[model samples]
Target: MDPGGEVSVSEAPSQVPPTAMGGEEEEPGEQEEEEPTAPKKSRLEEESLRAPMDAAEHYVELRAENLKDQEPEEPEDENLKDQEPEEPEDENLKDQEPEEPEDENLKDQESEEPEDENLKDQEPEEPEDQNLKDQEPEEPEDQNLKDQEPEEPEGPEDGGPQREALDFSHTPQMLTGSWAEFSSLPENYLKGCKWAPDGSCLLTSSADNVLRVYDLPSELYAPCWQLLPEMSPVLRMAEGDTIYDYCWYPHMSSLDPNTCFLASTSRDNPVHVWDAFDGKVRGSFRPYNHLDELTAAHSLCFSPDGSHLYCGFDKMVRVFHTERPGRDCEERPTIVKKRGVTGIVSCVSFSSSRALYACGSYSCGVALYSCQDGAPVAVLPTRHQGGLTHLVFSPDGTYLYTGARKDPEILCWDLRAPDKVLFSLQRNVGTNQRIYYDLDPSGRYLLSGDTSGLVSVWDTTHCASYRSSEELQPPHLTFQAHWDCTNGLSVHPFLPLLASSSGQRQFSWPSDSEDSGSDTDLGAPQERRQENCVCVWWSGPPGASAPGPEDTEDREPAEQEVPVCV
Candidate 1:
């Protein structure tokens, strides 16, 4: 700062008015020269004032000085102004090239509107058809709901499992002669039977504490066959005590070994998950009492998705993680604050579309709970005469079917209006045993077995919901299923078949006119000899060929069967 004679400023020429050229006379021609001189003086002053500015500010000032220098040059170019505006027009034309494709795209979209509208128009036609289906009150509502529900992993498509569409409009013909049966010894009477989820085989429990698996006979699939021979079990699972309950994994498939399993609970044993392919126990779920002593579950069922196993115990329900089978479990006690279902929980069933599950108690109570948190949703009033043994929800989740031990009537209750019974089905159930009943996949026909050894079929569509409870519903068809008590009935999941098991304790007494040993053995027996067996009957409408492996190639792609609406 001391070396320089004058202060040096690094900034733009300031616009501060230059010191007036006091002595200059402004003649018209001289005035323009004087204006130029004033600007030069201002620039000299601006350099000194800009000394304190930083580099960034200095750069900005320089840009301003350049713009100022360009100003006086503009008028010189004013004579060319007309040509400048036209140059911009040329530039605009070049810029519009990129926008041409966008205009074409808009045009393309406009042309496609009719096709999209056609698709929108077609979509409404389906809804119109669905409305027609809804107009028929006799049609089962589940058919429409299933079409709307998400397809299951094992749905019948894309080479997945397929089921025959069964029609109960007429009497079903027996697949083969009734002579073909899974005959059991008189000492080991059959107790119950269930169809595997895949409908490829049957599982039966006997009085001897043995569970047997019998594959569906191959001859039934053929066009014509001879008299079928007695069937035998392909696999046998022996338990230490009487089996309390057994349920096939809801998603079980014969193709996948991991999913092929069933859960069974016995009198004194922990719940065992048995491999369906092999008769070995895959895992065990052990539940202990408050005393920390191991206790057996009274009934077993897998959740709809098979992620959890629900086991029924006295006054409580224990849920076990399917993947981790051990003592650890989520205990949901039914009796909370001294108010809940009492007695042993005999059966549990889940609704496919709702987050609800139902538990039937031997105390003649039925309660529904949320599947999410196991919170009680509603407690149905006691209605059955005996301890409730089994309960099931209709496929549409709107109706509930319940049966009790030694109770002759199977009550159907409408969940929408749960205060009263919608209808009652009468059957002989004199003994304190679980008389299982099942509905077809369509939830239209209900089949059940009675202690009188008869299997009865009832069209649930005809059993109207009665407000006064006056309508008495009877089986549409009754057939002698066995020579002994038929305690179990299961409709094939998607097939036109029914599985029934028969046998109960029977005693024979010598006639009062006891003939010593003469010709007593030659005469007809006193009581009808007990027939302990499991039988499978075709439940499809007459003349419908049972779909089989060999039948797929010859069969035309069967037209989608329309829902039968009366």
Candidate 2:
């Protein structure tokens, strides 16, 4: 295919070039007033030019000014993305009832033989570089856990001693494009996805009371199912025959294998815990919801140990503490009745073993607050022009992945050091109503399933390392991975599998046998290139896990959750 004509889904746009509106003759005074603070015709032009800050300030200033409307691709961009929408066999596969799907087919969809993608390895594989080009470029995405030294970055324009508390940065990595087309779901939908820890298989909610897993090693020939259109909370709750927003627990740490619980929140407005093996509602809880009419647990999460459950509904994020073998906390969440929360709490997550709880969109932009105080610590500004759909913190808790409604793009933010955009993606359609998302335990990659019936992936390793340019160089593939917008996406908690839920089924991306890439980066360009998906394949030093064990120091008993403003 001709590179120029390829339609790629972009992630984060680097800079917006100055738009010269057709020359409109304006009066001198009018033109002068319209411009921002300009250079005073200072007699010190020569002296100022010779000032020490000249070179440093000029570079930073130019980058900053160009940063706003960037929309630029990375210097190390990948092949033109935006694939022709592949017609999935899922629509036809859906004719079968949830009561029975060939177990062998399900296994095949979830099976992968590493990155060779050669189903029949009987034949020798292609050369390494050729193989990489044969597959979607791969990159690593991660967050900065508090334990790691913060990455110092340029601050906001108003940032200075005046705004001491804001931990913003300047050297923000620009994300060029996302898997937007993959996530084009019908308006007003909810869904979820999971990536394998080994980057192999992906599992997702089928909205049919069954699970759909995808295997990526078989090439375009590989796939998964339960690919679904994002459905409503109630519809999802009923799809699985019992619950909604169901999920597979991470494989890291000490946990039972069979007890691999997939928790769900049903329309009965109860927290239903299920055994992943047979879809049995092992245990259920109401938590803070008393009235069946008012009770509805839309988002449900389990602590790493499976000892506790965190569910959000109405406008409050509540907890259900499980103690003895068969029982959970009789009391409701303390924060729900008290503390402060605005709008409806859309999603919630725990950082460093539940030491901190981050909730977002309920109050606009993502807010990071102490799990103990409920008082906000930081509110990472939303990267999109639209309202935030979902945000997930990297496993180590150093970075954050986010998605929004309107456009298909996933955004990355670093919290340990300077809060800056690491990258963005719109390839995966995580949700249509502009909500719903999931993250892998390693925190290196992000997937979103959108309305378009495709799941998108964003590898963020080169987000900060590459520059924007039009030149075609292999090492500089940035922000250029895309596929159909999926309804939901799932990255295996224990494997490297990524599954994106679509109209009726799913697809997968297993890690390639090839390493990310060698060191050497490119230079920033004076002019940026325009492409549908500008992605990069990077294999920088494998980012280490945020220091310390997952902090699961459980909280003490509470009387009841207090809602400051639900």
On lDDT, the leading prediction is: 1
Model 2, which residues run further than 4 Å from truth?
1-190, 195-203, 209-244, 250-258, 288-294, 324-341, 383-387, 417-444, 447-457, 466-484, 493-496, 504-566
List candidate 1 segments past 4 Å from native: 1-164, 176-184, 221-227, 465-470, 508-528, 544-566
Candidate 2 positional error at 82, Å: 91
TM-score: model 1 vs. ground truth: 0.66
Model 1: per-residue lDDT, tens digit, 311-363?
99998999999999999999998876655688899999999888889999988
Candidate 1 residue 458 C-alpha distance from true site, Å: 1.1
| Tens-digit lDDT track of model 2 for 351-470 | 764466666544455666665545566666565655555667776777777666664566666676425565565443333354355654444444454454333344445443543222
The best candidate in terms of TM-score: 1
TM-score of each: 0.66, 0.43
